[model samples]
Target: REVELRLEQANHARQEAAAALGAVMERRRMLEDRLRVVRGELQSTVVRPVDPAHVMRLQVIEDQSVQALKVVRTHLGTLRDRQRALRREAGDAGARLATARTRLEELRNAAEIARQEISAVAVEIAELRVRGESVAEGLRRDADASVEEALEVPRPDVDEDLESLLASHEAELRRLGPVNPLAAQEYRDLQERYDFLAAQLDDLSSSRAELRKVIAALDERIVEEFTAAFQEVARYFEEYFGVLFPGGKGRLRLVDGSDPLTSGVEVEAMPLGKKVSRLSLLSGGERSLAALAFLFSVFRARPGPFYVLDEVEAALDDANLRRFLRLVDRFRERAQLLIVTHQQQTMEVADILYGVTLERGGSSQVLSRRIRERSQPA
Candidate 1:
């Protein structure tokens, strides 16, 4: 819902930019015509050679015309720039609108699916309640015979015992308020539902046992998989760390050596000639490089289709930025990297660069450049 609201706002801003761009274009056209008219007037005035006495007057008029044309041209240039900016703003807003719409549709479909499932369960509940009431009504009408009379043996002694027990509690029964006309039916329906629930609970208990067995198996598999992956990632981490920081010695360790599955992981790096044992003790640039190495290590262990980063190298200096990009380049061989950053070194190394800028009126515009095309940044 919030996303929808934001989409509405973005659309509104886009429309406003469109309108503003049209106005600016119209104003620029008018200014251009005015400049042409001013030029024509100056031309007509100086078409013939002026006499000595009137030359000063003609010159004065020409100077004023030239100044007016300069002012008009300046205004036209400003309007044209404004129009370009507004157009870009509208384009960016449209992109946001499209993305928001897609996300909204996905959310709506998910909610609808859940509603359908709940509605189906509710329908089943209603059907079961009705069938239970029907059975209860039939029993109430044939009070002399039990539903189990055919299956169960006759027992007058047990019946007499139950009658005696009922007689003993008859005073308490009489102390109760008036009975409901549909109490028996309601009770029967509740009992039916309870029985259904009990059966469901038994099924659930069976499922739970199966799930526990599955979980135990999964735990064993996870330990095997995690241990293998951790070893690979740690190997990569150390190798990349050394390359990133020439003489650095970095190691990844599980807090509990015996239980890698549930243990916490620690990364310690001794950079170059430093005696630091923990990552936190390293300088900002050192830490950034260390983190980048660790990230690349995980990617090497289990690569994905693409990796996304936001200002990941913000703390790195130029030298470390180069190292970070180098690692990114190596990882890029296996996975596409999408990075959001303002660092020049990061931008320069990008195969395709995407950027967002604020136009004159404080509206955002999105643009992209491809390294393959040798496109220059503006």
Candidate 2:
């Protein structure tokens, strides 16, 4: 009975130790997994505190602890792989960051240089403007003084000298009047001849005065007509430019010469939102369009019987050519348009097409054809 009781107690003790060992093995496994996770997080820049107390708290049988240590060793392998990948990424990012920082410094230096250059240019421009104003003022003062001097100079009196000579001749003739009988007859004949000559001269003077008045009236009429026509042409120019540039605008002013007899008209073309003067400052196509607009405006105002346009669309593009054709169609009511162009669009709008062909013999011949179909004679 005593031996059986001792055997039963030893069996219970062995079973309890085995159960405790199993529990300790499970805890050791959990700690190994936690260590692997922490090591991985640390490689990825995640901070983790080491728990020596938790590792010491793990109570396992000797063999179980040995097996848990083997599991922890496997974590080192994965941790090494993670560390390698993280190091490569960090190295590439550092290189990129260094390049970006260098570029930022260079841009800052360039911006500072540009700012200094702009400040210097602004100072120079201000000084030049002031000097230019002073020079212009000095020139104007000199011009004024020269004009005053010219006005104060004396001039010869041609009309007064002629009147004095004529009066002296009349006095001499009167003094020799009614002397002797034969002398008086001769004197009377001479006086009659002189009176006839004087009457003829007076008629000539009156005729000259009338001619001068007629010329003055004609000049005034011509000036009025040209001024009105010029204004109308300017209005057409404005409309045409507005159509071409859409939202943009332009102005056409007629500049007159200083001398009336030698005076001529000049076109002052000013584009909207531009500071430059003259059409020459524009691009090639723009200059062509501006010239075309001016010519069209003149034609609209004057309205010739027929126009002779010679290759005027050479510089125009497809879009601009369309606009030009539209303008021509609008003007067709006022005048007949005869456009010469090699473009298909211009050929399409022709009423009577004339083709100039060079034959094999090198001679050019004009071939005229009516574009519209004609009905056959019945």
Candidate 3:
């Protein structure tokens, strides 16, 4: 049991660590992507000119590009560090899982052996009980035969001298009031033995009952503890979901009659006061918004170093798109957001923009541009 518990705890920790690592990876990828974009943009603007007088301006651009390259290099180093941390955590989780599996197998083998031994003992006990009952029956039959024989048997007559002696003894007993002390003493002894045996049987029964109750209580406690653990995890998920779907409300509930092993999450959305049945039912724009909300909620509930969102705003209308950008803006202080989009509005809202375009011969080129100012509100 302890091994199983340790394994479960290790797995939970591993999941949380893995989530953190994923965020970090996303951040790193975004940085690399941005770097690529900046490089591409610089290349597009620095096409070789036929005029020599543009040389100074070209040198200035090259210097700026060099500086940008240095910044990307530094970001790369940070990304490498994040990647290393994630790998280390994953390795530790794998090792722990291996150890848990080994121990669980050993326990299973021991339990199987115990079960076999118990089965053998039960069979032996049943056989012994059957033999004991047969012996008891035989003894009872013999005792009945002996009682009948005693009743039918005749007593031998006393001799004349013994009869005279007996007559004298009988006259003496009459004078002593016919007291029989031996019979009374035997009755008292039998009563004492019966009482002792009855007391011992009662004690044995009570002990067995108490042990069963204790085992039952332990089983209930185990269930309660597990339920509480599950609730804690559910609570975290709920809070995250709420954040992801702002202006909307949703919750997580354990489905009735559903096995935990087979259970899955049910997303309930009350967008604009109408309950949504399936995510697919939502429009393309709504789906994009919902997906983003879900992702954000997960991130908020279990925070990571950063997040990556690829082409996340492609389907949003202008208003919804701005809302999405604003959502990203809110998380800047808590987590770095890496966004990939082709929309100009999205690019306008970016702290840094990386563009990817195909060069003349199908080679992929990257460009980076910083948003100098926010576009005027429409």
Candidate 4:
């Protein structure tokens, strides 16, 4: 039945493959006809005059038709190969089905023979079980007689020599001590200590690994945050520095290259033509301006509630002094900027001011002043 079923499935598959092959062949024929027509059209001259553009268009159409024909032929060849393979597979499957049917018939005949043999063996087993106790006693006597005959047989002389050698080996083993009375307790104590030490070592190793992992995670977080802040600050620093010195450039970089977590940063600035490598290299006014730029850069990157600057623009010239006031004005829009400057430009931009003055007694007094604005005409 299984062989028949396989044969039926094989036939169905062959029919399906044949149908598909016919469809593929029909499609291939149609494509070939279309391609032939296109090539004939390309070779034929039109009644109108031929120009370069017309020739080019015909060339393109011919090329496309040739490509399409090659694709169709390639698919046709693939289908032919597939059809051949399917025919071969169907033939092989038929042969296998025939062989399997023969094998099944043989197995069925063998099963019939085995059934008869099993029935006979079952009857024989039942008859043997029904035999009386006398038969059992007779079987026991026969077994005893066989055992006695086996015992009566003499063994070879080499066996005694082997037995003596075995005795000598036993004597040699006995010469080594049977037990170590005191050593046992010492061994127990040593084993206990070893187990305790091993367990403690394992626990310590795991704890150390966990600690290292935690340290690595923390270090990674710190580096990520620091790098992000550094980039933002560097960008703002360049902007502020450019505004402070219109034609110059400034850069902020880490002093240490390899490790950002344990590194210091330095600023390099060039004002129009002067290259200032260090903060100390600048004049007092330039130094003040650079410091203020750096501070505002940090503030722009990470804004705060308020800021307090005490005469920070005191050393700047009128030009840089105006630039400084611009930065102050911009920052005041985003934060509460408190300036204690003696510069008139700083005072001019101030929305409100709290003036601090010293009394003769050496104590400082704080006073608040709201600058009144001029009213607009309606």
Which candidate tops TM-score? 4
* Clash count per candidate: 0, 0, 8, 0
Q: On a 0 to 100 scale, what is the lDDT of residue 372 in model 2?
A: 62
What TM-score would each prediction reach against the true structure? 0.42, 0.44, 0.35, 0.48
Backbone clashes in model 3: 8
What would the per-residue lDDT of candidate 1 be over residues 1-378, giving only the tens digit for each residue?
A: 343343344345444534544454454445445444533432331112112223223223433434443444454445345444434544454454456546555555655554565565556556655755566556656765455652243433644654554454454445443445463454445345334433433443353344345434544654575567668878999999987988779988888868654456778889878887886687767876777676667666766666677677777778888887778766666767778788988887788888798999999999988875423321
lDDT of each: 0.58, 0.52, 0.50, 0.58
Worst 10 residues of 2 by lDDT: 46-55
Q: Give the Cα RMSD of candidate 2.
A: 59.9
Residues 69-183, model 4: lDDT tens digits: 4554454555455455545545555565556546555555554554565555555545544542335455558765454454444644654654555555455445543434454
Query: Using alpha carbons, what is the TM-score of model 4?
Result: 0.48
lDDT of 2 by residue, 141-260 (tens): 876545345444453364355445545544544553433335335334433433443343344335334434543453454346445655786798788776665545666553443322
Off by over 4 Å in 4: 1-182, 262-264, 273-280, 357-365, 372-378
Ten residues in sequence with the least summed lDDT for candidate 4: 43-52
Residue pairs in clash, model 4: none
- Candidate 1 TM-score, true structure as reference: 0.42
Which regions of candidate 2 fall more than 4 Å away from where they truly are? Answer: 1-181, 256-264, 271-273, 348-354, 358-378
> Among all windows of ten consecutive residues in candidate 1, which has the lowest summed lDDT?
45-54
lDDT of 1: 0.58
- Between candidates 1 and 2, the TM-score winner: 2
All candidates: CA RMSD in angstroms? 32.9, 59.9, 28.2, 32.7
